[model samples]
Target: MNAPAIPMIFSAHRRTLRLTRARHRSAGSDAARFIAEDMIEDTLERLAFLRHEPARALVLGDSTGTLVASLREQGAAVEEPAALDLEAPHPSGGYELIVVFGLLDAVNDLPGALIHLRNALAPGGLVMTHFVGGQSLPALRAAMFAAEPDRPAARIHPLVDPRAAPGLLQRAGWKDPVVDTHTLTVRYASLDRLVADLRDQGLGNALAKPAAPLGKTALARARAAFAARADADGKTAETFEIITLTGRRSLAGT
Candidate 1:
């Protein structure tokens, strides 16, 4: 894919998301769906098998605060970053376990970011991450096109294709890197609600230069297009393909 040409994500965009964390926490239990609490829970399940429970863990994006809490419940010490800028280089060494949630897609340099994550781990330390991936939001994309058939603006951030992930992991020097994806389908009553959920989940526009919001007339068309695709249940379907990655700092050295 032509990833480099696309300004994947702006650092400032993430700061806004972090600032809104309180709003997400107040959205009630159902907010988990938007904040990806399920994915964090799923990944946490695998921690049952770790022979070494991490004493110093760094959590990159736990907007929901679920993963960090879960780690703490295991009697492990967990710390979170005050601000995480995916475009910048991080310190080379610290932390034994790093569990990232919902932050990778906006990164401008995937390879460098991955290298930083690998380097952040102490020897024998592990890094696990999840983010929305390539096969995501086809319905929303179609609606955007219908909104402005003549000239559709770039609204969505460029996402990582799972197919290209393994090679990237290896290139970053993560030993025995693993990458996989699972699809989650959600149905929305209207396009507006979908957009609201995205904002509530900190998945709002993170592009370096975001397009202007749809004009009044264009929005009407996009809503109509979205309604046209609704199933008999009268809800439009949107798919999110969650990609998971895991790698470790090797005792044997890279």
Candidate 2:
């Protein structure tokens, strides 16, 4: 029997456009890079703790460029491709280390992507990927709901739940897979700032069929709803849960 068809919920073209726009924004101005920085830091720490040194590494979705520099400083030959389609098979393989920053969350066939990552690695190679998890953006979600309480649309892209990651890794044939999650909290004075930050960090919606833009009245309602949840300091707290998945290819190349 043929495998079940993967749902086409996300558009690869839109995802590329979002990333391109984010790169342009970052180049023209000092856009917020806290998300990428955090992922790089966490990845470096994990590499250090495990004492796993790689002679060759492939880094993906590293908008900040710091991850590549750091890896180079460690004497590793790193490849930072200008563009790569996560849903398709990688052009090159035999990487000893593969680190992905943010693209996994937007891929339509996540399990297939994971399998591709595993296939790209050499025997005993390590793969680490970090992306926003399902529990993130409660404040933004609430505000979107308030924008169209009666006829809400699908504005936010669905995220991966940490609970389902292990099964995905197993299906991908990863050896010694590990799934971990942590939350980052940020305080925003307004919903606009929050949305801007998300766009700056390349976390914009990449759904195949995005909802129509909010009108003036709906936007006002969203702003008001967000402001209503502000704390005494006149800022609303927003949480982002980052999920990290790490695993190694079997020595037998399975």
Compare the candidates by lDDT and give the number of the best one. 2
Best by TM-score: 2
What TM-score does structure 1 among the candidates reach?
0.90
Please, what are the lDDT tens digits per residue for candidate 1 over residues 1-254? Answer: 55447344566655456436634553676553554666777677767665658888998767767778878988888888756665566654577898877778877778888988887888888999998899999989999999999999988887899999999999999987889788888899999989877766767787777799899999999999999999999999999899999999998554
Q: State the C-alpha lDDT per candidate.
A: 0.80, 0.93
Q: Per the 3 Å backbone cut-off, how many clashing residue pairs does candidate 2 have?
A: 0
Model 2 ranges off by over 4 Å:
none
For model 1, what is the error of residue 96's alpha carbon versus the real structure, in angstroms, after optimal superposition? Answer: 1.3
lDDT of 2 by residue, 122-241 (tens): 999999999999999999999999999999999999999999999999999999999999999999999999999999888999999999999999999999999999999999999999
